[model samples]
Target: MDAAPSTSSRVQFRRRNVASRARWVEEAGAGEVVESKGKLWLTTGVTRGSKLCYNVEEIGFLVEKGALILLNDKDEMIGIEAIYEKIAVGKYGCSWDAFQAYKHLKSLGYIVG
Candidate 1:
């Protein structure tokens, strides 16, 4: 019989439980500005989801792919690809609008990742 894999060689993933009121940092191109609640929010290229809400914020760095990098307001990198469709549509206008925004940003030579 084949021997089982050794526990020492196994990879472990620790799930982080975000607090209810936790804030996220979103990373976007240096000049990109995201608006919310009449205030200017930076696009960290990161989005996050919760049982009751979704949050978007600014990020100081960039990530690969179109994945949004989420961070806390303190500038600490936290999560990625956390933005969901429903929340994105609601917050960033509609699906079509969001797509347009993505394209516009990309055309400006800013990395969307």
Candidate 2:
């Protein structure tokens, strides 16, 4: 019989779980962000779906990608042009992104809130 391959040093992956944002980014590059068990999970080596993050929409716009859309927890594509416009005009205000930013930074191993 043929000899079996040795595999005792490889780390196993935990599905529906995220290691960290910095780890996710380093491993995923630009993978979709998923919220599982109240934590962000990325497709490290598995297939999932796409949900755009609007915080970097400016870069997308600058890159000539046109209007950017975001998705909710349900993974539905939704427009946000009006919201950006409102933000630009100070018609609407928000701190939701701030919270996510902090969470992301923290997940990325930063000393942020």
Candidate 3:
């Protein structure tokens, strides 16, 4: 498998707060270019209108994989630690543990939904 890229190669995204959910919107280049390079959407998120939106877990997974560089509304960069804080932790929630499990399974060649 191809290892995640370094910080320099990460794709940039701006966090977009929509109602109760926070969506990460790709901030650089065309969506097609990013999709071709990252196989984006195939792994996470959906295209809404002209923007590519990613769920919280998808943001965490992409960032952890060194495939994303998330930005705040102010255009400041966000780190993985900060991103982790946003992931909810509770029974029946999209918790960090679940994300870890998802990542592990994907690493093992499992096709996670």
TM-scores of all predicted structures: 0.25, 0.22, 0.57
Q: What stretches of model 1 exceed 4 Å from their correct place?
A: 1-69, 73-78, 84-87, 92-97, 104-113
TM-score of predicted model 2? Answer: 0.22
lDDT of 1 by residue, 2-50 (tens): 9998756222222333111223423421212222221112332333241
Worst 10 residues of 2 by lDDT: 59-68
Candidate 3 per-residue C-alpha lDDT over 21-103 given as tens digits, one digit per residue, 9 for 90 to 100: 23234352111113323355576665667756665666676666666656665556677786677665432246878877876
lDDT score for residue 66 of model 2: 22
lDDT of 3 at 43: 61
Best by TM-score: 3
lDDT of 2: 0.32
* Native-to-model Cα distance after best TM-score fit, residue 112 in candidate 2, in Å: 21
lDDT (0-100) at residue 91 of candidate 3?
A: 27
Which regions in candidate 3 have their CA more than 4 angstroms from the true location?
Answer: 1-37, 88-93
Q: Pick the candidate with the highest lDDT.
A: 3
Q: How far is candidate 1 from the true structure (C-alpha RMSD, Å)?
A: 13.4
Candidate 3 — worst ten consecutive residues by lDDT sum? 28-37
lDDT agreement of model 1 with the native: 0.34
